[model samples]
Target: MKFQLDEQQGGNAISRHDGQCVWVNGQPHRASLLVPWRGEVQPWPLSRFEDLTEAHFEQILACKPELVVFGSGARIRFARPQLYRSLIQARIGVETMDLGAACRTYNVLASEGRAVLAALLIDPE
Candidate 1:
């Protein structure tokens, strides 16, 4: 007998992750990327979490997701709330976590059919 997992049914899932890279759908992605639950994974120019600004957040907001899962590099980091003021105004939710944790959370949320976007900032080894 076989059990079918929710994430295996055509939804994008994080297949693996490590200190230097993350694998989405079994492909290794070394740089930062924006992974939407139902669309393409786009490259995010900002390499580090500290480089995040209002403009960066605005670009993610343009994707029109109900919530954003922010993977703040190798270790958990918090951003200034003012930087994401537009999201708050738009009533979009943002959750911060380390890259590994964020990846796991994104898989679960996407499997549940939530309109979520994982904004991951990968740090170099």
Candidate 2:
């Protein structure tokens, strides 16, 4: 689906997303990645939700986002707290949802100028 957000001065906003791809700044990306409100979009290097590890959360920790919106592929699946223990310890909030919701939520927070990150896992078809 396509999205229309009041363009913020500078930040990465998700313009569209579907089952297989997500559009960031009008560019389509078909792999798992980390999208911060500002700065370069980095590849997450994860193929599936089942393969998630704490190390993955650690990567996010380094980004220092106030919150993380984790899209668990095509479905809404919650990861175990243990998987993201480090984040909780750091007081960084994390929310999980299906791919579509994650994309939408990320756009909203980003547009509002909040420090948020979208950790999307786009499973291969």
Clashes of each: 0, 0
Per-residue lDDT for 1-125 in model 1, tens only?
73337345766788889967889888899999999897788888888777889998998999999999999988899999999999999999999999999998998888888999999998773
Error of 2 at 34 (Å): 0.5
Model 1 regions lying over 4 Å from their true place:
1-7
> lDDT tens string, model 2, 44-111?
98998889999999999999999999999998989999999999999999999999999989988898
Model 2 residue pairs with clashes: none
TM per candidate comes to 0.91, 0.93
| Clash pairs for candidate 1 | none
Q: Which candidate gets the maximum lDDT versus the true structure?
A: 2
